[model samples]
Target: MSPSQEIELTLTPAQAATGVVIPVTLPSGPQRLRIPPARNGDLVRARVGDTEVLLRIHVSGPPAPAPAGKSGALGCLVALAVAAVVVGLVIANSDDDSTPTASSSPTAASTYTPYTPPTYSPPTYTPPTYDPAPAPPPTTEAAPSPFDTGTCLNGQLPDSTTAQTVRGVKEVSCSADDAHYRVIQRFPGTHDMSRCDANPRTEYGFSYQYTLNGSVINEYVYCLVGIGSYSRA
Candidate 1:
């Protein structure tokens, strides 16, 4: 701002952390700004007073050492003098010891780095906040469909997998959507299927034999009436 321009006082208290909400006044009205916390000696921008101007504020860095008054300086000098006299007396009264080793040493050149204070940028856009823990990740697992273990529920067939042994048939998919075994007929191994075969004949099928192909333990053969084979045509 020009020398004549001045900032109005703010109602917000000083802050030393980020995301502090500062209350400021503008010619338009009073407003709250969420400005990031700044270190001492940093310049922060905020609308102040009854003008359109935004004022640059200097943050106080470290605390300044208290100025030594005249009396304090004199006391410091007297302390230094007393310390020197005591040291001299101690040396005069000390017993002789090994001579100290001396080595030539190089003095390091003093370097000064220019100070660069942090500058505050406008805060980024922040949406409304929600505090609740994120909704528990979806409860379901990538599990085998219920149909994988049994026959179709109602009439909804299970999405096919590589191979599922159901009844006496190891139903296998033949297409993208999958081909399934809808048992058109069932019979005991001891009984003949000659009079119970599907009209078109099942393309592929097997028995539930446990020990051998067609063993008596799983004597039931799940027969398919029709393969349901069809193309886009």
Candidate 2:
């Protein structure tokens, strides 16, 4: 590194292999050095006349795809395949040995007990003699449906004039013009009366029908309250 300390190096081709050899000589003096070799981006390690100095080396071309020891995985796979083949061969041989061997000569007929069917007798059927009787005429009219008039007392809105007749927790009223009839009541709101029955009030051309009992009525009341409280009036 100083001005007086000078070193020179030269590279020559080796005759045995396609590799280069570098020879370096230090200045004539009593000296000790741990110096490294000259770095030229080549695939050979630089050495001082075949003497390694810091082992500076460069390798060209792509690295080997797999390392040497990694072949054990492939070897193990091959070994397993071979082992499977060996085991399969062993099993096949065992099966071949275990099976009942066939003989060239025909075997004697089996002396099995013969199966006998039981004798069954058919029964004789006798036909009965018929006596002609006068036939009665069939009833034409269908009997009235017992629950045909099963109308809910609170089912309909009464006419205005007939409003005074029926009174309960429920109220029924109609306009004088008969244009609007409302059956407003706190009836049992257990079911969705609008579509509850096959023949609902809506189906019969009634204005409105609803149940007014239990949780359903409570829900309706709560909804009405909520609407009234939050409505933009």
- Winner by TM-score: 1
Residue-level lDDT of model 2, residues 1-233, one tens digit each, is: 22322223222222111222222233332222211211222212112222322222333444224336668689557435533220100001121222322112222111112247799999999999889887866545443221112222222333332213222322222222222222222223222334323432322212222223321222110011001222222
Task: List lDDT for all candidates, in order.
Answer: 0.36, 0.26
Tell me the RMSD of model 1 versus the true structure. Answer: 25.9
Q: Model 2 scores what on Cα lDDT?
A: 0.26
Local error of candidate 1 at 6, Å? 99
lDDT of 1 at 158: 23
In the range 55-93, model 1's lDDT, one tens digit per residue, is 333344443333367576775675455332201000110
Task: Give the Cα error of residue 60 in candidate 1, in Å.
Answer: 99
| True-vs-predicted CA distance for residue 49, candidate 1, Å | 99
The RMSD of every model to the true structure, in order and in angstroms, is 25.9, 34.3
**Candidate 2: worst 10 consecutive residues by lDDT?**
86-95
